[model samples]
Every structure is written in C-alpha cells, then in structure tokens.
Target: MARGPAATPNPTVAARDGMVLPAAGPGTGTPLAVRGLTVSYGENPAVFSVDADFPPAAMSAIVGPNGAGKSTFLKASLGVIPRLAGEVDVFGKPVEQARARIAYVPQRASVDWDFPTTVIDVVKMGLYREVGLLGRLSGARSTRAMRCLDRVGMADFAHRQIGQLSGGQQQRVFLARALAQDADLYLLDEPFAGVDAATERAIIDVLRDLKAEGRAIVAVHHDLSTVPAYFDHVFLINVRRIAEGPVATTFTPETLQATYGGRLAATHLDELAITGGA
Candidate 1:
C-alpha cells in the first residue's frame, strides 16, 4: 500500500466537532494503519512515533494506563487531532479518502449531556452526510435511525431528552448514532466506561455482531480484565506502541508490565491469569 502524508490540523474536522462523514465506499486492505504517528500538546508529546495496524473483521482494543495517550493516538489516526508526523491509511487508502467508511464514538465524558436534544434526534445526526445537515429526516431515514436505536435497546427512549437519560443510556444513544452511519470501521473511545454491566454487554454484543458481518471495531479500552475476553486483537501502548497482535500472544504479563509500568501490580496480573508480576 502507498503511504500518505502526515496528518495536519483539519479545521473542517474541528469545525464539525470531530464528527464528519462522507459517502460510504467499499474498503479494501487493512482496516487501519499508522506509522510514526506523533501528537504533541505543549512541551511534551502525548503520543510519539507509534506504529500499529488494526485488522478487518475483528474487535481490537487499545489498552494502557491513564495519561498513556491511547485516546490521543486514536484521535490522531483519524485526524480528529493534528499529528506532528505520520502516515495513516484506511483500507490501503489515505484516511481522507476513506472518511465515509469510518464512524467514531468519542468518550462520553467529552460529550455535553446537557445538550437539548432527543435520543432519536441525536442518532439522526449520523445521517447528516446523507440527508444534509438541514435536510428533514424522511420516513425512511427516520425509520433507519429508529432501528439503530432499537439495536442498542434505546428505542423506547427515542423521544426522551438526551440529558434526562442515565450515563449508560447516553452511551448507548451515542453508539446508536454511530451505528446509523453503517460504516465499515468503528472507532470507539471508552465505549464501556461508566456503563452498567448490562449496557457493556449490550454494546459488546452489538460490536461483535458488526465484526461477524466483516466490520472492524477498534476501541480505547481501560479495563484489563475484559481485554482478553472482549477483544481478539490487542494493542498495548504507553505513549508508544508496546505490543500488538493477537490477544493470546501480545496481551501477555510481560507486555502488561511494560505498558502499565509499575502501575500494574502482581495481584492484578495473577487475576488476569497472565502468570507474572509488574
């Protein structure tokens, strides 16, 4: 595959509040690939010289400690944030060319729950690229949005105010919005954070279904215990790529220690059944 130029600050992406989409396309090659990716904020770089690949038809997790730049890497790879230097490709093409096939679910904390909008209306936003920002949601589009909400088990809450829902409900609404896009690759930042076990299971089940249908699911996940069970591919990082590959091989005790540094204790490792200490 050909390498693309380093991603720069994209005012269009920034202007859209980091949610932009184009017409969907039939993607080819790897789902996502980044080489020498670097992102800086102030004197220090949040992510530095990282290289990684997320395969198609699999659920992959980017795991690391707090402040490890896991989110930064995801944002930069998608050009949601500016990259100092790196090449990012989606399905063998530049990310810019493949925006249509990508969908992003940002952290729930980053969203303003206070926003005055209905759950169904929020999901309808995902169809903006198809229906135009000001275009009215026709019956078909509205029905599609409702179906997405139904898939996330939020159909009953469709008319409810977004702020009026619980944290887990809010997360499910966002996931429904992403699902409305019907993209080939889903980039989720902490989809399981702050959600109840039922919601987590619901979200993972939906994601696994997407994978079964040949879509890619890449998420920035924090829970180490669920990594092995929920994800087939794991990318361990600490501001840089630590280890990446199948969960069985790359998510070992040694890599966990390296990725988390001293933050991962021996008891935690034993609990994870990795058979080693930090």
Candidate 2:
C-alpha cells in the first residue's frame, strides 16, 4: 500500500502544456486511465495531480468531501469541462476519440426537473448521440427505450411527466436514460443523493447488472459506509489523489482521514444498511 500521496508524475505520461499524465499501458485490462489530471477554476485548482486506472467490468466509487473536486474530475475526464492539465483515456484511447463508448449521469439537482418532458422522452435523449437530434424514434427505438425504463423499475412511469414524479422516481428515470445509451462505461454523479431506500437499491441493482455484463461503472458516492458494500474499487481524492485501489485494502480509515480530515470519524462500515427496501 503506497500511502501518503500520489507519486511524482511518471515519465511515461506525455506532457501537454507542462501537465504530465499517466500513460495507458498495453493490456492493463483497464477501460479508463487518468494521468496527472489537473482542472482549475481560473487560478484555483479544483483537481491537482491525480492518476488512476478503472478496470473493466467493475464498480468504482469516487469518494471525497465537498469542494474536493469529485464532480470536477468526472466532467474533466469527459471533456465537458476543460482541464487545465493532464490527459484522459478510454480503452487506451483518448477520451475525444472514444466519446461514444462513455455515458454520463449528472447530479439530479443539476437538472431542471420542471422541464416538460416525459420519462420516455428523457430516456430517448440518450439515443440522440447515436441517432442524432432530428432522428425519429421508430417503434423499435421506442420499445428499446421502454425496456430501459423497465430495467430501472420505471416502466409504468414512462408516460408521466418528469416533474410529477418523486425524487427517487426522477433518479431512476436518469439511470434509465444512461442504460439507453448502451455505452461501455458509465459515469454517474451522486446517483443516490436525495433518493429513497427503494430507489437506492434499484439503482445499485442496475449498476451491478451493468458490471456483470462486462461494463465499467464509476460513480461519485458520498456515503462512506455503503462504499465497501457497493463497489469493488475506491478512488479517494482531496484536491489530489490520496489513494486508489480495491475497496477492502485501499479504503482504509487512514485514507478516509487523509481525504476528509478529522471530521470523518462517523464513516464506519457497521452503520445501518440502506440497501434494504423503503
């Protein structure tokens, strides 16, 4: 266990504008690799030198405190937010070149629930990247969308307006949308935030299914207790990479304190499990 902080920038990672990134090795079995990734808001760096590899067919959690750049790292990796430095690779290829293989679900709060869109309509939006904006959703595509909704246990809500549903329902709708994308990798920000216990279980079931199918699922998770139960890997970040690897070994109390400071005393593994139904 290499403790403390991440090592100095590896020479293998190429330099871009003075930002050194970790190079993707051949046959590393990792779908995603980030090297020396740095993102800044004006002069303040949101994410400093970070490096990690996300294995294929696994669930990984990005854990950190507020303002720890969890969301910033996700956006920067997807190129939705411009990174001040570093590089991101998907399947050993640049993110831009592998765009179609990735799917993203932003925070529920970040979306406007008031948007006059049906549940099915929102799921269909996932196909827009593949089918194009003007492309029509034929009977086949519409059926596919319905199947995705069914996966998230929201088939009955397909006709309901997004805003009319409860918070948990809304989150399921977004998960269904990501499922419709049919991408190789999924990046979700706070998928369980503000959702009921039922919704949390439903989402976790779907994510586990995705991992079973040889796809990668990376999520920004806040609950420390459930992390060990939910994910196979943990990537801890606090402005910089604190520790990243298997949850059992890397997600230690020491790393948690290093990432969240002294206030994380309550992040224990024996708390009440929310994986049960509501």
Q: Pick the candidate with the highest TM-score.
A: 1
Q: Which digits, one per residue and each the tens of the lDDT, describe model 1 over residues 179-220? A: 999999999999999999899999999999999999999999
Score every model by TM-score.
Answer: 0.88, 0.85
lDDT of each: 0.89, 0.87
Error of 1 at 146 (Å): 0.2
What residue pairs clash in candidate 1, if any at all?
none
- Which candidate tops lDDT? 1
Write one digit per residue (lDDT tens) for candidate 2, span 101-146: 8889999999899999899999999888778867777899999999
